[model samples]
Target: MDNFWFNQSDYEYEVVEPCTYQNNHSVELLVGQYVHSIICILGFVGNSLVIVTYAFYKRTKSMTDVYLLNVAIADLLFVVSLPIIVYNKLSSWSMGPVACKLLHGSYSVNLYSGMLLLACISTDRYIAIVQARRSFRLRSLPRSRLICAIVWTFAFLLSVPTFYFYNWYEPLHTQDVYMYDGHEKNLTTPQFVCEFRFTNNSTAWTTKVAVPSTQLAVGFFLPLLIMTVCYTAIIVKLLSVRNFQRHKAVRVVMAVVVVFVACHLPYNIVLFYDTVIMFQHQMCEASDALQVAKTVTQTIAYLHCCLNPVLYAFVGVKFRNHFRSIIQDLWCLGKRYIAPRRFSRVASEVFVSTRRSVDGSSDNGSSLTM
Candidate 1:
């Protein structure tokens, strides 16, 4: 029997000659089709709103703004790939090998990039708050943009293995057996699956262990370590402060760290376990359980993209005010185009008043600023 391990971003792994257990295909379908669809929708909307708000309403005045914009772009690209991935899961890979490599590689790239960007954000915060005197010169906008470029380049390098190894291949599976004329014959079916396909057995170790270890280290563990250290120091600094907003700042930092861990930890744990099991023989039951866990946890990790805007952008008072202003402007424009001529005047007056209120406000308690 051959057992299959399915990872949404890492692709699938096939283990041959495993003890047979009933594999539930419905779980994959349910999560990939429905749960992933919901995530895709929410992620698209949330990331898009962040991008639009940043592009139109807010200027990239600080390093945090630049990092947030890049994070939104990375997440947006990740969510955009979901529909294609869902289609591939529901049916077969009709999009061909080029599309296969590009889609999977891009997914891996964005996954790594998003996590790395979060780490960058955490480090920036630590510098801004914990090392305030040096932050002025260190956190310049040009330097931040350069750092973002370096991050993207490094993420692409991390994803090179996926691009090289992933391809659409048809694997033969034993469907059934029939006895005819005292002879037993096996029936086999070919199913096209998008997965990492090595050229030979010599590359198995590299693909199975090294590649995944790199992903786990750079994509999850590295970010987690950076965030943990940076946020810890930041909280300590906040505790020593006399500012009233210190408590609020501490809560926001805790929320960011908690959400990051809650979203990615389960999936990374399962991934690490799966990576380890690749080297050893495992029972079919264990592999089956791992598959189900991976499917569910991977989707949970994807939910982070949807919450990024809420946690990083909308949490800031300035961003919320800007977003509100955008909405008001849209509403006034709609009224001018669609409402009665008498109502247009009222809409214009309302829009002007709202703009004045937003522009005149002195509320500078932005979560990122702290």
Candidate 2:
């Protein structure tokens, strides 16, 4: 392994170090990669299942359903970018400039989109529960469509900076000139680094303190506050009402809130730590410690993309039913030729009967049944 690359500002070049891992770094990196792989695979499968089910079984024309669909779509798009992250971990970026920008920018899209959808879901439930009758007239299909458009637009705009930051640069060894591209120029060393130079005269306070603090306030902290207040009000109103369970609307809201908290809260806490670290000049005494922290923070953040799908499918009874139906249909397709017609008929009958029993006699009962 080569020595560490030193940043030289005199010459616009950087020293490139050969990629090799020490034992400690190797273990930490391996663990992170393993977790990343699990998240990518499971997130993809789960989100894909939700998308298929939402498209086929629960084709209801409701605003809440539309928001759920958006959630699934965002997760799918985010997880698709995981392969690029995996490659970045195992080796130096082999993909060209365009690919790097697109791939890295996707991480922001998933984060913002998922959070926006959560906010939408919370607002939806708040309206549906707090002013049940009034909300029916207020939250219409067109409004939902408009909100979704705004959400996507906002996400795309926020992610533009990510693409802007991506660049390929070589390292500089001495404060001297060198050949770069096709011309003789003042260049750094040949070691390439993917850098995002946020500010020309930015301090640790700005990068670590200001940016992340704002993100925490707007992204995680504010959303959490709104969700808590809305859900609290909802729960109180639900308790006061005699037939809240009969409507099952309250139950659905509870499930959504619970899952959102479970899947996302940990990552936000990790982000808080990262924000603090971002501002600090020295992360730790040892290089290994810094690397370990990076691995952990990245892993926690990345896991959110995977968790969104699983939570949606498991939290809502309707989502689970829709998912099961798709799975059954896929399974039957493979075995239809070999299986007897009598067996298939019996299975179908049993499934319908069991579903009716579980779903209850009425939609109201079915809402909270699962």
Candidate 3:
């Protein structure tokens, strides 16, 4: 590893070329921020609602529904960390040391959990539908619960090393400088940096990179391949049997695959990039291009937190109906509150009373009685 001087303290500061004072704002950043915030809120709310509504409102205890519940739970847990990314975008990691580790750990855990749960979903659907003759007693609630427990536990276990390694560092890099007094002085300042540092030992490599890479292979890619094969077989079977149930079932399974690919791809890409690609480049000098790449990739990764809810809309008819009802109810509530009959009646009664009194007629409000 190349030795580079960096501020090891909690806070560092540096003086850079000051920008000319201007009130003009950046539209791109603003738009990105808005999109990120909205997605975070939607993911949080949508996933949570899925869990709550399914758990309470719906009573059928199918293995498929249980896995869907697990997915929602995983997604919600993942989205819980998005606010930190949102804040990281707006500023830097103002969150203290504890929060930094927990957020990163939770994020990683849920990322793994989501993929595992999706795999479970795909596998369960395939078994229930394709291998219908087999005793799918494994798909019972107890078995489903056990699988969910194992999936979550494994996700947490996989994320443990990340939790241990990641930390909040205040980085200060040397910069060439010129002072106002015609003298040059290199200045140091605190930049809230989020990075992982493991002891320079052999175990660090295996623990950090090799193990995680293996987990990615086992947890993500293997299941994805299995799903592809299962879906292919299922599709061939469904095509042979021309019936509505087979078509609907195939649609549901396909929707799961599409959702899994769309939402989880960015997160897996981020993991691959950070663990494999960036490992070699971490020691390289930080250039604007590298910084931009990191920012864009991270943004894409965080965008996954929002995609699950959109997937729910596409895949789950129940979710679409639920969402539509929620929107309609909210709209009705807004109209009822904003233009209530009580306020309008009060104003009209006041005007009618005033008019009747001004006419010097009967003080009783006869004309406006109702």
Candidate 4:
């Protein structure tokens, strides 16, 4: 949502006239706010479940799962910041400077960390599948942890500049600001809008031009290129295999790529366009339309945080059993309908033995472990 805030005043206009840039879209504003609340709640619950699943339930995990655990950690952190975003949309920012920077910077860190992690997952999958029966160097758990640490470090460093740009700025002219209408546009409202500001010509080139340029390049374009190369090569190798199951690991790979392109690409495109327009200092009359588009696309982008659990984790055969076990345990309802039936005697005996051994379950009680 912070990425979608393209304040019209953030852009310079050479032609001056008695212009009234009031957002008369009350219905759209209400709908966007409703979507904001829904995404906040759903993303929080979904990502929290992901963290719980990986932390307390799953005992053994692959290298891909390790990356996913860090991804879930990033999403959970970002989901907690959703209230800040909703508050910005619904009211003026009253929280102090530290809170503003922390909230906005966390959003930036999420953007950078999530994409980089997904790219890492794709690369790992490509190696595991395409390089089947071959040995690779960085395939161990230690290396996986090191990769995650590096990603977290890089993500925090990437957001360091955001602390400089995002600050509470008083309204110089309410008419030109074009704040979110959900703020009510009170004529007597005396509050600061926490946002990224260029301040003057000296900082404009760096804040407006450079920051967004770097964001689009590293946050979107570079990840897009990496994902494209990895997934394409992976698909080629899968097609050549004689016994590759179409509905197995392959479907999960396709889902990841499809979800990424669908949810995040439009927002990134709008961001890239905004950066270019700012650098060119062009004046456009379609600011209202562009604002609505950006808001909608960014809201759609929030779906990715919720969908990561379903698309990546729930799609796995092993995770499905773990999810069912957790749900059954939470409700105190035994798994009578959701679990798959084991036909062979040996398989059923193994399932019962493993379930009891893994979670220390008794005839009466069970733990969260799986």
Query: Against the true structure, whose TM-score is highest?
Result: 1
- Residues 288-320 of candidate 1: C-alpha lDDT, one tens digit per residue: 888888888988998999999999988887878
lDDT, candidate 1, equals 0.84
Q: Write the per-residue lDDT of candidate 3 for residues 116-158, one digit (tens) a residue.
A: 7767766776676677766355567788899899988988888
List ranges where model 4 is wrong by over 4 Å.
1-21, 24-28, 133-136, 174-189, 244-247, 279-284, 333-370
Listed in order, each prediction's TM-score against the native is 0.85, 0.74, 0.68, 0.78
Best by lDDT: 1
Cα RMSD for candidate 4? 10.9
lDDT of 2 at 242: 78
lDDT of 1 at 368: 66
lDDT of 2 by residue, 1-370 (tens): 8889766776686666543336436755676577767887888888887777666555535677678779878888877887676666455566766777778777677777778887777777678768788886877778988999998888778776666865655434323676779777764433444545454555434444654565567667767787888878777877787784534656665766776666566666766766655535652334445556556665665666666665544566656666676666656554554686746776666556654543442333111223
Task: Return the number of clashes found in candidate 1.
Answer: 0
* Cα-based lDDT for every prediction: 0.84, 0.65, 0.63, 0.71
The predicted structure with the larger lDDT, 2 or 4, is: 4
Candidate 4 vs. true structure, TM-score? 0.78
TM-score of 2: 0.74
Instruction: Kindly report which residue stretches of model 1 are placed more than 4 angstroms away from their true locations once superposed.
Output: 1-24, 174-190, 340-370
Candidate 3: give the clashing pairs. 12-189, 12-190, 13-188, 13-189, 13-190, 14-189
